[model samples]
Target: MPEPPDPADPHQPIPHSAPWWRHAVIYQVYPRSFADADGDGIGDLPGVTSRLPYLADLGVDAVWLSPFYVSPMADAGYDVADYRDVDPLFGTLADADELIARAHELGIRVLVDLVPNHTSDEHAWFREALAAGPGSRERARYVFRDGSGPDGSEPPNNWKSVFGGLAWTRVQEADGSPGQWYLHLFDDKQPDLDWRNPEVVEEFHDVLRFWLDRGVDGFRVDVAHSLVKAEGLPDWTVRTGMLGDQGEDGTEDAGEPATTDPRTKELGPMWDQEEVHEIYRGWRRVLEEYNPSGDPDQDRILCAEAWLPSQERTMRYVRPDEMHQAFNFQFLEMSWRAEDVREVVDTSLRAADEVGAPTTWVLSNHDVVRHASRLGLPVGSPRPNGIGAGSEQPNPVLGLRRARAATTLMMALPGSAYVYNGEELGLPDHTALPDRLRQDPAFHRTAGVELGRDGCRVPLPWVADEPSYGFGPGPRSWLPQPLLYGPLAADRQEGVSSSTLELYRTLLRLRREHDLGVGGLHWEGGWGPDVLAFRNAREDGRPVTVVANLGEDLLDLPEGLEVLVASGRLEDGRLPQDTTVWLA
Candidate 1:
């Protein structure tokens, strides 16, 4: 049978006079920690708008902002109470509009987070559901089921929360008795919406329009695989630390099977179901509706936060009528070995080609430990969810070396890529962050045993000698910046020729000029198993080969080519261990 058609059937496909995001360098900004404009000690929209020139200078085509919608901040705005408004904690709705206008002026598109899977328990819909009793119209918008056993006391299933504990939470009835239970896949404060409810479907379509009308370019759909649940809400066969559990490397495993063939996993009960595609098809129409009014250069796009069992499984997330791109967690979780990296790249490219979607390579993101420190862990050691250290632990020197090289390799790949906010500075996770400051729902719900993602979300250091590392004009930051963060501050590295900032700037400048975004990737064999070599052609067909040395010995590059970029200094004209070079 022939495979699905390219650009799945949208009522009207986004005009691609140039589908600019296809191979775009899109930066993910964790807003609260990005910059603080007000004296509130947290980053806000005003702060982000002020930093627009900074991102534009870095050469990113778009900025994917993490959740900033009105919320109780139960899960750092992921538990959204109002999808149409901005959280005062981040900024005002006006602030968001101004930020959107300013970003477009700078030629940078903006993609806001769209959390469709769940809503804050404080949402009006959920509140009404609580007041109206079970089986009411409001209650119908959510999953409200009667319990099994006598008196309907037990939870409907054996399902557990992704954060921890039971997924069902029993609410009191109007008569002050324990009533029917509701499902929450994440934190208890986040109630899962019943996608089966037409009200919920129509509500999100309106939410998509609210932002698109405000000039936002696209959406980074949160929990894209989770909006729809299995028809029966059947209990899943639980495994040790499975189901929303992070692997040893601090990457989301999503209870997948331990095999390469994603089909074997059959993770159908709660994730990646066939029903989810219809939801995207609907959303695609919403996105396409505004394409006529949008800048052709900035057609609205949808990128999924789907963590599937394999690259092949992930490929389905981007079929024409669905999302434009989906996060490739498999590559992020792969062991830092030359052969392992090469195999993932080869498979990822082949899979993406089969579906006609741009492959997205991401090394670091908000939920995982910083790739800088993760590379320091032993090859087979589980990447710690949070390093949870009271003192210096991971080998920073070694981690940064690998991180720099890894990012260079990632940028030289065939498709779009993501740069976590602090990755450009080669920031390591703050392993020693005090437990009391921890706020991730995972950490609190698990009583700190799960350390959580707080370590990687620390406020970034922007100035060396400034208070709070210039994260804010306030007295203190939301998450404390480490003392070591001083030297790595953006201010300190701004003009230093050898600093990480300069390296990123130079690389971005070169990447855009070479037009590598629209290029093809070809593997160059003959470099030993210790080296991964691949050549990417520019839109003009000029070739640049990226050679990364993952072994312990130094090696000569393809001779006679001029070196365009290197993650580390060249020693005696040979590439050293844990280094990457781009040759023109």
Candidate 2:
């Protein structure tokens, strides 16, 4: 028989979390789908403000709002027309200020989304760039290059947009002639800015001060890794994934392989470059003004939306004077195998330990498939952008079970974690959304070959029986809702003890009390290969072991192990398959 597990802290007193970002749980709120007020069939700042109480009750430390900036909605607010003002579609600038104020009142910090990689084609700067001739000062702020082919008919080189087609979009000259081609890593409506230009560098500093001067706490830097490029704009040597579009503010993980080999990867001319660290170091200075540990409530933070070749490369973004936190895309990509989970966790913690930064873990985000659904698929299935329509359907029941187990496993680790919006309800992707209502540019640009991220961005359901499931007072939601949403609405699960929402609340509360987020984790291998068992021990000697069962066979816990919580109900004295249990 396996040796009995170490004693866990069953009755240890829990304490409050540290300063908002230093060691806390952050929740991602995709503002467009979180809630809709004013009955416009779209979510707004006021709707988010109204839901602050819900977030606080759920026990998250801070809320990261996706872009609500002024935009023409070409790429769903990402094609920003104005960085300093809130678009009327979401609310006014005054509403944004009020939302920040309201969030602070509830002891919840707010981090607004900031898109620095590109601006909407309608932005004043882009307009000026268009009006000016090539080689002019205005055009210098953007990546406008001379075409190589005769009469400049061909693009400058061969670079693809993240949405689709060539990355370069030809423009009409001042004299009404087809002229220079400007680069846009994403949709044609959003042109990539030239960070080498001093004006561009100074402008972002001003934008940073603009939000910091306001009551807002910090920013989730969109496309954090793509701001700078190579010295000579070299051609690609290592190409990964589909062709045509390769830009989504540069967050694509390069479709890395699943092998555990110790090898280095070349991310090419435009990704995870060494020069990006200098830019973040500058942002760190701005963040320092508000990061006084004495006032933990008002601290500031910077979250990098980086998808590097490895978690080790991702850690350089958080090297003390760089960013406070960087998303662990490697962790998010790990398969559901016990050894894969252990490898990513060990590598992540070891990487962060060297940099003296807290290891941050997240399961899902707006641009990716929902973890609940993703987990149900075979461990090594290709997750190319979004699951193309009718490719592979997930087992909803299996997915939810794995998702819950994964969350428990993530939370029990030793660092901060992020919970994507609607994750608490165990919401799966609306895989069957009608093609007509699909709004993601990834879908239309690729002509249905690439389904894009719309399946995960459907408007959330707030009430079971209300119109639009209480998403708004409107008759219908902006995106179609699945029929099962009525059964999983917040109103239906609010007070139910067995609901996923309640499980999240209880887990967070217990996580705080157990001091699990600030410690070191050690794996226990005696329980066999299908089970992942680890101990998170604090300085007080109270170790909490979170064990997740990944196989069909039931795993039995040793006697006298007091169960603090579980992802699913226990079977006799054994932990059910696809379940996680926290024991002392």
Candidate 3:
């Protein structure tokens, strides 16, 4: 492991002044899609361990593994059945320990996803709760309510599930008598727990302690903002299509009020209750307590996936006493506009400042379209279009240029940056999968309007030509591998100077060697209508300027800044289209 930088140099500035996460680049691994070790066509913990060296070589400080716990495979393991043990499909508990050990051996931290809001209905606890009588402690652990009202109607409220339709599901009473309704925020199989219950809190805390004790480093809290809900379960006035609708409201012709919905505004404070801070605070206390004792320098991190839009709501998960950081989804929604990027960056910084906590940004994840695809290139266009539509040639060089520029922008920002697996390789989005092969629920829910996230969650391509792309020696992977990935394999680009792999290495090394921190951001010069320019200076006075051209034309360089790193070769400080440059 690399030694922590010095802290006592007034003139030199403290090395490693940034928290473990501040300068750290996190790589997200969707476990089921990463690599299949057992060749049962499913990726497992041991498969991940086999790829530790590959991750270490990518220059990430930590690997954020999506949920790998035991599950019925619903929601891709997000519906966890066992928090304390690994699923038989992934591996045994020993495999998890070994994966962690291998990651630490490479100076990489392991952060696992913790889905606390709900659990698989098949979970032992939930099953036991269903088997027990009413008022049972196990039943109290989840949201269970009697349907016997003045007239035996539906659920008490009209709250909609995130997966569409009602959030309530009917399950048999403890004694196998009749059925009763229970609340679930997602699939019917996932029943939301009653956070108001004291025992529920203690049980979740114990779950955290169990993992922390087993050598897990931290957690990426799933649906972190959904922990609390309105106790009254009041009827949400039918005004809009649904509460969590991302695009057009689906309630247009339903004879409901389409112009304004009284329930829309009230949803936030009610679902994302202010009391959530207390819940996170409690979890943070458990994390701090269970962290390794001997290493005072080691810091435990808790990152939350907050879906709320406003800064005030987003900051609730990141207050000093709560989670260490919350994901800023602004960049994920960014279009091909420099102004939009600037606004997102500024808004996130201001929000983080307000809460006195660090900020985090992610370009892509398992849920969204890859940046290359989102950037308006033709579906699967290998290289960025230089100027005209016909110039759709594979420019591996330009691809790396874009990757480097994106990295430069992310690293030079005020807080931590998350890079999805295979992003460093400039992997393009998959767009040709047949409908039968699609795995994302979005397709079914959206009625095929959206292509679903399965395009981004395909198996990682490690080799150019080998079957399964070196994910394993299997005839086929858990998910189909994109044909375009073959030419961009790790083996093909390992030592190449211009490879995307090398650019990532160089950028990560620069971030580490410079000891950059949150205090390093210093913006200067008015941003062009289509260009983003900013300078980041370490406390020690080492300044690096990042300039990105989000427009079609080449951008004129700012006077007096020397080019340090260019996404592509630069002539007289002028950047080519779709280019990025790092200047000293």
Judge candidate 3 at residue 525 and give its lDDT: 61
Give the alpha carbon lDDT tens digit for every residue of 1-584 in model 2: 98543333211222344554655889999988999998988999999999999999999988999999889998889999999999998999988898889988898888888898899999999999989888899999988888878899988877666676677889999899999998887888989898888899889888888999887778898878887777767655233222212333223333444111113445656666787788888888876776556475666788898766677878889898898888888788788998788878878877787787778899999988899999988877656466645758888999999999999888888778999999999999998887888898867876876678888898898988999999999866788889888899999999899899999998899888887887667777688888888887876867887889988898889677799889999899899888999998
Query: Where does candidate 3 clash, by residue pair?
Result: none
Candidate 1 to truth, TM: 0.93
**Who is ahead in lDDT, 1 or 2?**
1
Question: Which candidate do you rate higher for TM-score, 2 or 3?
Answer: 2
Question: By the lDDT metric, which is better: model 1 or model 3?
Answer: 1
lDDT value for model 2: 0.81
Q: For candidate 3, report its TM-score.
A: 0.87
lDDT of 1 by residue, 1-584 (tens): 98653321111111223478777899999999999988678998898898889998888889999999999999988999999988888989999989989998998989999999899999999999999997799899998899988999999998767676788999999889999999898899999999988889999999999999999989998888887888889876452132234433324454444221233445647677788899899998898888756665647899998877778888898998888999888788778899899878777877887788888999899988899998987764555677887533778898898899988898887678899998888899988888888999988877766788888998888887878888888658898888889999998888888778888888888777776666667777778888988777754546888899998888987778999989999999999999999998
TM, every model: 0.93, 0.93, 0.87
Model 1 spans with C-alpha error above 4 angstroms: 1-18, 239-264, 293-296, 390-392
| Order by lDDT, highest first | 1, 2, 3
Q: Which pairs clash inside model 2?
A: 14-513, 161-245, 161-246, 162-247
